[model samples]
Target chain A: MKIKQISIFLQNKKGRLYDVCAVLGKNNINIRALNVAETEAFGVLRIVVNKPDEAVKALGEANFVANITDVVAVEVPDRPGGLAEILKVLADEDVNVEYMYGFVEKATDEALMVFRFDNPDKATEILKKHNIKIASEKEIKEL
Target chain B: MIWNEKFECMPAGELKQLQGERLKKLLPYIYNNCKAYKDKLDKAGIKPDAIRSIDDIKKLPFTTKVDMRDNYPYGLFCTDQKNVVEIHVSSGTTGNPTLVGYTRDDIKLWSEVMARSIACAGAEPSDTIQIAYGYGLFTGGLGFHYGALEMGLRIIPVSAGQTSRQLKIMQDFAPKILGCTPSYALYMAEEAREMGIDPKKGNWKIGIFGAEPWSEQMRTEIEQTWNMLATDVYGLSEIIGPGVAQECPNKIGLHIYSDVFYPEIINPNTGEPVKEGEDGELVITTLTKQAIPFIRYRTRDIVSINHEKCKCGRTSPRISKIRGRTDDMIIVRGINVFPSQIEHVLLGIEGTEPYYQIVVDRQKHQLDEVEVLVEVNSKMFSDEVKQLEHLRAKIKKEIESVLSIGVKVTLVEPKTIERSMGKAKRVIDKRQM
Candidate 1:
């Protein structure tokens, strides 16, 4: 299912992650799942949240560049080679995953992965052909 | 000969008159030959016919490094490539190299200038010249090699490397003249002493060091160890190498061959030529070069000039010892701090002249920190360890006062810092932009 994700530019310095997350916590934005993509000096913090608009507003108020991007959430078997299976399926269908990350889990049911791909349609088709289960937008929204 | 070079030693009026006539002649040749110059002249609305004297030469746009780079590989050469017997290039770290073409006469002139420099340093035809400079694209080695040959000296083209092998050659060959960078000469001396060989025991009478700017203190240190008169040779690969001007035995300043190369000191910021004795960027206008003619080529070297006669009996115009270049100055915290300024501070502080490193890193988003790593001399004493922090603090304060920038001084052991064979890149900027 598709969900809105916020990207935060953070300097590659100690406590930079803490500083951003601190701001989010103070603003009452619960960070669902996040991953940091880094170069040398700066990094992009990709964050999934309960309220995308509110989260972005909070981050913006704190004087940072925050933008929302669409991403998909997929449910993979919580076993060996689950990520490999999803990767193989995507590779076969030629869906270039710009980035991917795992979300925080409460139980050992299934691994929830967030993926950004060049073509969302191609990703959905590939996932469907491989019998990969995608979390419904309502399910993610409710969760 | 070309513009009566003898007039260079004459009074100011006669010299200016001769230069005016030469500039008048160079004007037409340049206007006809160089397309870039022609375009610039056209843009400036300057007619070559209008420039009848040296004063008129000032009206023309001065050619600079950008001009050379803009023209690239061949556009700047006045003569065709067939007439060009040799080509030298500046180290093009950024992009395309600044190519300098040398015709037959140009090569001869280069050799002649180098020979004159060698003669000024008390080198003779009978001296065994060990050319320890780097060869292959670098002009230091071959430039001196040609000059030594031209001056009828025995040339040993042992171009740069193998400290032990070089020492062994020096031991057996007993070369009277050593030609290389000043730092290499010092390293060689240190190695010789370590190897139980005295550099003074050899036939080495004189050492000519260049390809890098150094202080009189370095020359004194080298002279003390090698027991040879060490002289500084100055040149740029863009013009010619290691022979544009050189320090005579008087050791006051470099005697520029003003007859062939007309010089002007210009404020780097303003681009206006400074008055005589004023400190500014040294710019040169090649008066008699055939292949790649340069007019007012801005060399960023900062130095004062003295036009008066030297005690060495040569009336050639003199350039004071080069402090550093405009490009070498690093802007830290909005302050222009030269590495030489740091060196001056370090040398002033009692105790050490050892190898050092300068670290530049950005801290706390907007702030920059400078950490200077200098070696602690042995005489600091075992008890001085407690006082080391205090010493470092004092050093930092002194540096801050001198360069007007806060710096952290890190005192290291003697020879702790990495040593370089050629030019030492001691300053490292770790700030990620």
Candidate 2:
């Protein structure tokens, strides 16, 4: 399954990050996870929020630069090579990972990998055939 | 920095004597070598030997910055072109760029004067100076680059960019002094606060900033925040880059290098010399320059002058700190303002970054409205919406207090101040020039 994430473009100035935060707070949106990819002048704030629709609307009202992206979330065992197995599966399917980070929480017996790639549907289908546990919107929001 | 009395007692009469002797020799050289001047001299019905003294310069036509640009790329060199060692150019946005040529001896003299200026600011051979000015065609960077070397100090040639890199070098190596623009120094200070570093607790003792006009309110804020003395250095590429004159320990006016470059305050109205302690356009005549000598060149900078002896021992005439460029003066709502006045007020206020722009546009009924957009600082912001609004109100109040004019204050987030790699644009006027 693929989860939706909203990325906000932010300038690296003092009040820039605060302005974005203000908009999100006003719309009663909760930021579940965030990754700030930055250059000298600006940063792309990649966020997994509790309410994606609200986040997008709030960002739009504020004239903030933002976009929605789909990413796949998979379960890996807590054991060391559990990620290695997932990578091997991804390798066999020829899926290239532009960037990847882990969800702070784990399910009953697995850690979740929030992986972004060029093609999300193909990645989800390939991982599912390998008996990989794909996180749903509910699962991702809980994490 | 301590001021020496010996330099102050040297009279203007003595400086003028050397300038007169040099002018006698320079005019004939320009008439023979420079085609543009040869023509101008003929059209004005002037002879090379006609300018025998400093006052005789009034009879000769004054060269403008545009004249240098018009003769770009080798039109003004008085000495053999092959003997010219290096060329420094001004950053020209609207027209051809002006060029300053240097011979081997001229370069040596420039570095020596720069060393003296730096030393007067309390810098020593034992200290390390971090130079953050840009390098290359822009003289701000390389001019100081050579001066630092000539001063025999340990210099970290950390060319101007990447505030983080500058902080890292200042932290690790602990240089006692930093040379850069006032805005860049403020940027470094803001970045330090963001990164959890305390600039006041660091090793930097002083900051030497110039290349643009600033105000006293700004100097106070910088000195207070960085806990270091922020001094000013003045020069233009057309007038020999960053080593024309500098502020001594007195911290008031800058003393001209009278022995090398003669200083004259000419009435913009009468085209004649003004008495001492009067505001007029600055005119410089290079005395010892062999590459390209300027005779009564009108530099459209408006400033007041004083011939009184300074506490510093340098016997050079001092000009009241430059108020602003005459050419850059803008009239808004029929009131004249140099952008420096607005910048001064914003810098004086706490919680505001040093980056801002002034926009002049027509309102209903063709009235002009002035808008100053300032970059809102992040370190002071909070989750509280009231706090952000309060910051805006505070900025509006400060600007109104300083400028005595109500301005539309727009607070933008960091990095929102449009970035310029060189020669920042701070003012935009809708009026046709």
Candidate 3:
């Protein structure tokens, strides 16, 4: 299953991250998982949030260049070999992961990992064939 | 399209003779009429009567901005105060401002030259021009205003600012010619898009952009932005407003009306003339100016000149687009660096906004440090960090290679750098000493 992720462009300026957070907070957008990819001059802020379209619209209104990107959220068994098991399944099927970040669900025993894949559709098919549980947009928001 | 065939197409020999005659007459007139020129010529031990031809113009002394400042308002005017019809004052920024007084005849001459400048930019009598240059003491607005009236073009006279109103007028009146500074033209385009109008689809077929030094790369950017034939118009208040020279459709260089305003390029420090096609400071002499005639006035604008005839068949000597101003050239570690040079390189590179600011600082014992801040916009931004880093590194490497100095390139957010409705300020030097 695919989930919508909000990606924002931020220049490496003072308090820019705080400004982005403030915009999201003012709009009552709940962030499920977030990570920043940073460089010397600028940073790309990626967040899995409730109401991705509304978050993007709010950021755009504040003069932020933001857009929605499709990313797969795979459910991992809450065990020592949970990530490795899913990695092996995708590795055997030759599905490449561009980037990934994980977070443990508050009430569930499973961990949720957000992944950007080279070919998302192919990766989604591989996870389905291996009987690995995948999270949907609604599941990501409910987390 | 050729405004005045007799003067514009005069043969080289005849033009030289005309310039020599005008120069011979101008020297005596200024020396006799104005006390400033009298003292300068007497101090240089040159007799005004002995200077017979334009060749002897070198023997005369150069009039610096200090001369204008020392004279202040109305001291260097060659005519009586009663004869002066209007006056324009330039922003001094440092000391006393320089004043230029225009007699009725001088205004007529300005109108004639500006009419030639407008026509040189491929404007016709039927075409309408929306002049965005500021009016009042600034010469740009009224210069184009007087010229368009002379050329019989429908005038909009929307003198600068009011971005939304300017766009609305462009749509409603459908003026074919737009006259303003190049930076303001770009700003207008940005504002036009924000107002839900297509900039390139506008009806501004010709743009006469001047009042500041701009690079050829900037010309291309403006041309692509508005889909207009962007031409450079060159002039100053001291010389005679915005009609000193103009670029023809050939786009090689701006044709200086040498018969009326004689031009010579000289080394800024040595005052010696440079060879043809060599970049140096431009010095102009108002050969026919009545109110305030300048004899070899040092313009301080760096440019090269071409004496050869242009493809447009104008025999007037053409000057290259201003490379930089002597006043604007910042020396970092004994190396000359121009903001325009960095702009030229930046415009050549993809994924860069034209807005940039150069900051220079010096410590007590350390070498001069230079940093260029460029704006990052939506078109230049990416969703990956590595791509943006690559962009920053590319900018630094390209600027360093072009300037031959180590420069720190800082990518700033869009609109961080100050925008201007007139001349865009591009430098910030913080060194105390």
**Best lDDT among the predictions, by candidate number:** 3
TM-score of each candidate?
0.65, 0.58, 0.60
What DockQ results do all the predictions give, each relative to the true complex?
A: 0.02, 0.03, 0.27
All candidates in order of lDDT, best leading: 3, 1, 2
Candidate 3 lDDT, tens digit per residue, A34-80? 88987766778888888898998898888787867788988888889
Clashes of 2: 9
Candidate 2 residue runs with Cα over 4 Å from true position = A1-143, B1-11, B329-433
lDDT of 2 by residue, B148-206 (tens): 78878898888777788889998999998888777567667777888999989877677
- lDDT tens digits, residue span B138-254, model 3: 788999999999999999999977888999999999999999877678778878877789988867789998876556777888899899999999998898999999999899999
RMSD of 2: 14.3
Chain A alone, TM-score for each of the models?
0.88, 0.89, 0.94
Worst 10 residues of 2 chain B by lDDT: B1-10
DockQ sort, best first: 3, 2, 1
Error of 1 at B228 (Å): 5.1
Candidate 2 structure quality by residue, lDDT tens digits, A25-57: 888888766677655444567778878978988
Residue-wise lDDT of candidate 1 within A63-124, one digit each (tens)?
A: 56567777888888888998898889888777888778888752238888888876777787
Off by over 4 Å in 1: A2-11, A36-46, A51-72, A78-101, A115-124, A136-138, B1-21, B31-61, B69-76, B91-96, B126-138, B154-207, B216-230, B267-273, B323-433
